[model samples]
Target: MDLLSRGSMVSRHGLVLLLLLLIGCVYADSDDQVFLEINDHKMTTLSNMSNGSGRNEQICTLCEDFASQTLSYLQDHETQTAVISGLHQVCSKLFSLKHQCLTMVDYYVPLFFANVALIQPEEFCQKVNLCEMMASLRLPNRDGPCTICHNLVVEFLTKLKDPDLQLEIIEVLLKACGKVEDHVQECKKLVFHYGPLVMFELEKFLETTDICAAIHVCKASQGAAVAATLLADA
Candidate 1:
């Protein structure tokens, strides 16, 4: 069978197994029984995969494809629910790490989704050790004032999912804006204007807005247009 066919088969079988496991757990006598049953299921599936040559390569390909597709969907949708659902769907297709995939989805998906704006597929694959040799992608330098402002906004947005760092992040952004010597007022104004909105409706803001442009810090082909416009108006 082709990879697509194989993937679909794996996914269907995995989902069935998942259903079975859930049903079995409901009747099991103890937590240990449930845990052992899950481990046994996972080991059996993994052993089947390991029986063939190029199994490692197949697993790597599935993982890379999953990361790429998940990131693409998250970029387009920009919501936690979209990413979580995509992760679960893709995870079901994997020939190995079935249980770990579910666990990682719960623990790491939030962090990955939070930085979806900044992350690249290859970087994510590498981070999970699924594609070790791929180089990390980097964003270009934001040397212009408005670009700097936009970067700060992106930085703040990327960390919005972390409640523990919310106050510290706000302080950092404010301090960073305070130091922009050339456009100190504009920078701080953008922060003060959008800061509360970010706190209240982060996912909606991400889904529906180009925040930097909304703040007048970035424009198509004219990164410094806002500063120039302010000067011309003054």
Candidate 2:
């Protein structure tokens, strides 16, 4: 080939290479922009979720209170006739969501009484999904139900020296277990079985003991942190 043809061929190849480089740069910039946008969206979503935690907590408190009140009423009026009358009285006193509360009581009271021996007020709230709603709103890095149960039990053991606070701690731990999802039944069972013992034989259980493992929420072979992460993911 002549010099002119050879030079023309070289120029064509260089132009093609330049076009390819330009396209590559454009795609690189686009990818970076997309990545930034996705990260920004995640941050915003997390912030919104964090802010909503307060509202969730309030709802959870209401559910717990309702459960406690209902249980008290039932215990006070154990007979079928009294329970029927008390249900309406309880619903009337709710002040908020009166109609809905009545409906819920009508629907859940039978189921609750049927399993009354195995379930507590907190567990009842969970079975009805009121407290479970709060559990669903748990934020990133927040403790899972099992971890919360473990920590509360440990706290109860540590504070066993306070006679006045023993029952209060047990109640709080039981309520916390009600909000648990993955191991709700197990948590409640453990709390009910061991909670009374905590008050009676304080010397038998130690704060250092692995209560989570005792309840089987955490396995002996697996780390507590690992079990917690698995539960949280579940």
Candidate 3:
């Protein structure tokens, strides 16, 4: 081919290469912008959380109060206390934080409701009052019978062996649950469905007859706050 013709062909290839490079640069710029936007959004969310946005001041104070109350209950009912004690103690410590206090409360508040949602005074009349005065709460903006209440009572009656200890537990649960009204229905359903399973495990634990079974029971129940606690952690 002639030198001029060869030169023209090389120029055409060079123009195509330049266009490809420009397209790649445009994509890279678009990707960088997206990364910046995402990073900025994440930072804004973290900032809002730090500022306690959309959080109630009352709930913040209650978290600390709850931790204190649980510690007190555990201290008072030393003999009957179990894993629920440890969960409160940790939550108590976490509650001391000025930060994320409401979120922690939000986690625990529902479990308390579920813990005592089933007890009925009539049902437990022959037995201990698992359904004590505190247990019979008419949650605000709530109506209808609990879907899980009856089965929960049955489980409490048959599956749980230590009636006295269980009484103290239900009382403690009632106290916490009584204080918080948020997510009452949802938490009750979660516990009502899952509480029997947990109790089944606890019932098996109780049957072990190991001297340290109480300690293990306490460990297992850590989430009653354990149920709420584990579910919250999840």
Query: For every model in order, what is the number of clashing pairs?
Result: 0, 0, 5
lDDT of 2 by residue, 1-234 (tens): 011112232232222222222222222223465434433443343343333333355546645654564455434434434444545554465455355545544654554454444446566554444453344443333655455544445433444556545555455555444333344454455456556553444323333244455434445555365444443454
* lDDT-best of 1 and 3: 1
Instruction: Give the alpha-carbon lDDT of every model.
Output: 0.43, 0.43, 0.32
lDDT of 1 by residue, 1-234 (tens): 011122233343333222222322322333554434443543343333233333245344534555565455555643456445655765576445455456545654554445666766555554434332111111134355354444444434444555545554454445444322344454455446455454545533443344444333456446445434432332
lDDT by residue (1-234, candidate 3, tens digit) is 011112232232222222222222222223465434433443343343233333344333322333333334333333223323333333344323312323434444334333334433232231221222113322222321221222222233342455544444333333233222453343333234334344444443323322111222234333133233222332
lDDT, residue 83, model 1: 40
Ranking by TM-score: 2, 3, 1
Q: For candidate 1, report its TM-score.
A: 0.22
Q: Using Cα atoms with residue i matched to residue i, what is each candidate's TM-score against the true structure? A: 0.22, 0.26, 0.23
By the TM-score metric, which is better: model 2 or model 3?
Answer: 2
